[model samples]
Target: MPATTIHLVRHGEVFNPNHVLYERLPDFHLSSRGVRMAQATARYIAAHSGLNHAAAVYSSPLDRTRETAGEILKALNSVREERGEQPLELTTDERVIEAGNEFRGKRIGHGDGALWRPENLRLIRNLHKPSWGESYDHIGQRMSDFVYEKVGEYPGEQVIVVSHESPIYSFRHLMETGSAEHWMWKRHTALASVTSFTFDSETRELLAVAYADPAAGVQ
Candidate 1:
């Protein structure tokens, strides 16, 4: 049986001049530099022999993810056209979205007024389960389910999934270490990076995992 590959891609930087945690908020699109980064990522994937043959593309419903996926689709379609093949369809999956955060819209800097509030301080008690918002296990489970479903659907082919930083990193950590209890400070999933996984075609078990920053040095 042939192996199947899935690429979990993190979206580019957001246009947040305020530097607030946009977590699941609406209208938060990618910045201008982020658009360039997205384009560069798409080009990189299109040029990659292993990933350019992706059967389908999926992304989160957020604006940033949608925009990033659109750029990827465009680049992938260009490659398909060059190769005389049809373009793959793009779909949205809510399960692959950013992890929910109770601190949404609140500035977390040292001088920020919201960071020093008594109620906000109380929410920081648990870093393992993360009391401020969604638990790591929850995000890992949903991401795992999504990956299983997609790998099953597109056996022996590649599937591209565009998602946020936390979900992608959490799922990658779980797959790599078999544990999702680590603190967020350890993860360094960069913008427009690709974290890939290969699975057994028959058993659907994870066979290998890899990471790449296609848009590296493209700040």
Candidate 2:
């Protein structure tokens, strides 16, 4: 087996006018700016010689992630056509979906919302394990499992996984430091960002992790 690279991509901004936590909700698609961001990311990946040859592409089942992955698949297919290769297929993986949150559809702000209600204070008591929603460790474990499975399935090839912010951030943290403790400041997973991990082909050990924002200039 040869060294393989897996790119964990976060989906573009969602069209949530209510500004609520749309965790795992259905029918939440990407905004107009998000569409541009997704297209920009797809173009960037297609332009990169190393990343354009993706052997497999996986995405979360959520609509936003599916839409983002759709753009990437289109770009990848275009590149493949230019190279005279077959188009790559896209797969949906539930493990890469957004972390479950108790405050789904709730407005989180400084005002008197459900997040600030006295009854919901207990949910914030354990930010480390994150009593508010899915535990950090659980999210990390699922992400790790998904990555390892894919690595074995596609040895020596580049793979892409489009997921949500928290899951990607948790996986990155867990891989980097062997811990999944939730740290507010460390959650800097930008929308439509690509966080890549290089792993040894035989040993399957992580070699390096890199982060890039293809839609950096796009507002």
Candidate 3:
């Protein structure tokens, strides 16, 4: 039986001096340290024989995810060059993009335009369901559709997907527990972390799930 593995990688830290919620916002690139974080994770993926063999690299259609995917492509391409294989190119997908948020441009402090304003609190009453923005079910469904499509396209091969925290964790949580409703504060999807799901190509059965935080020590 042929088995396929899809590694979902979260984007590195963003260069947000104002610390505003930049969800799906334009021009929010990676910070200097964030670049290093992406590099660290890229090295981790390149050093692993299985990961270096990934057939395709994918990213959310956002600056931060694209930047992170760029670093991984550089490292993976180097390995491919050594192996006489064609270098992989990146494909950005909206399905794996950041969750839509009403608090997109709000800060987190106790200021006038902060995220914790009384008006904002009303929308955030249920942390698990998230009434303020995109629902967890929608996020999980989109991610699932993306992964299943890739599995069909690359059967038995490996692929890398760079995305945001909520999409990654929501999808994984859905796969693990059959429901995407999860505590936001309890998300284990760190920046530049890799969460892999291995499946039976013929049956599309999820065989295993694994996670790694290569940039945990970057700070």
| Highest TM-score model number | 3
Stretches > 4 Å off in candidate 2: 109-113
Q: Kindly list the per-residue Cα lDDT of model 2 for residues 102-154, writing each as its tens digit.
A: 88877766565646777777678866678888898999999999999888888
- Residue 191, candidate 3: C-alpha displacement in angstroms: 0.8
Residues 1-219, candidate 1, lDDT per residue (tens digit)? 789998999998889977777899999999998998899999999999988989999999999999999999999999999999988888999999999988998876756555657878899997878989899999999999999998889889999999998999889889988876677888878999999999997799899988889888786
Worst 10 contiguous positions by lDDT, candidate 1: 107-116
lDDT of 3 at 156: 93
Global lDDT of each model? 0.90, 0.90, 0.95
Off by over 4 Å in 3: none
Least well predicted 10-residue stretch by lDDT in candidate 3: 120-129
Q: Provide the TM-score for each candidate, comma-separated.
A: 0.95, 0.95, 0.98
TM-score of 2: 0.95
Question: Which digits, one per residue and each the tens of the lDDT, describe model 3 over residues 1-219?
Answer: 999999999999999988899898899999999999999999999999899999999999999999999999999999999999999999999999999999998998888789988998888778878989999999999999999999899999999999999999999999999998899999999999999999999899999999999999997
**Candidate 2 vs 3: which has more TM-score:** 3
Clashing pairs in 1: none
Instruction: Estimate the TM-score for candidate 1.
Output: 0.95
lDDT of 1: 0.90
